[model samples]
Target: MYSLKKELLKKHYKGDNKSVEYIFNRLTDYCGKPVRYNMSEEEPDYKWDFYNSLFFVITVVSTIGYGNLAPTTSFTRIFMIFYALIGIPINGIIMVTLGEYFGKSF
Candidate 1:
């Protein structure tokens, strides 16, 4: 029972700020003490849902060039211009590094 409580406590504290707050709340019920921690939600400037971001990053690095959904604004377009200049060579280097690592591992 103690192990289970400890595990639950550990699990609760393992995520970001909101998660720590939740864990602290649950801990209060167990410990019979009023815990206080003011936690604020972290809202990302450009929120990329995990799965979508994964797909987008994979597509970018893999050089698949799927043009279905792309940048659609002046600012984003301009950013992409700079990104293309710096990113392409960096991405190529990363791909080469990964390939070498894979080759060695295999």
Candidate 2:
């Protein structure tokens, strides 16, 4: 699941919608592992629907971190180094491209 999210973040940073959807659908297939909620109960708290997760990931990739969620362990922190290495510049390029697109569109 972590790898899946990493791939999605990378694809999103690169502005690849098809790759993003591919990872997202894969999440649907592997639903049991990487359980979204925190607890084992009749109804777990903070059930993240697809779009919510997407939004969370976008926030993470774009570095607009609201701090409501975060990576907890050293391993994840290490992986985040790699994630940011690729994601930061990709995100910047995408932002610039979108700004140009919108500027031309307007």
Candidate 3:
């Protein structure tokens, strides 16, 4: 088990041997462990369903965080970075528009 882990660390890891552990831990901290996510298979599409996607977007835009619904893939993670950057301002505009609409109505 240990050898396999070490072998994987060596195979995928690009850093110098002395800093492999440090790089692994640092990268894992933000990116999370893909192996663990793969092991615990939940829904076939975690955010594909309408409500699930809505919930995910709400959390991301509101800066409430994903909680347990973390992005596992590198592409999804990178996409989410852009998603949040754009979504937050869009959401803010929607909220302000609604507030003005309701205020005028009252």
Better of 1 and 2 by lDDT: 2
Output the better candidate (2/3) by lDDT.
Answer: 3
**Local error of candidate 1 at residue 54 (angstroms):** 3.4
Give the alpha carbon lDDT tens digit for every residue of 29-56 in model 2. Answer: 6774433322233433454779777776
Candidate order (lDDT): 3, 2, 1
Best by lDDT: 3
lDDT of each: 0.66, 0.68, 0.72
lDDT of 2: 0.68
TM-score attained by model 2: 0.48
Cα lDDT of model 3 by residue, 23-88, tens digit: 455546746643331223354556467888788889999999847677889999999999999999
- For model 3 the TM-score comes to 0.53
Per-residue lDDT of 86 in model 2: 87
1 against 3, candidate with superior TM-score: 3
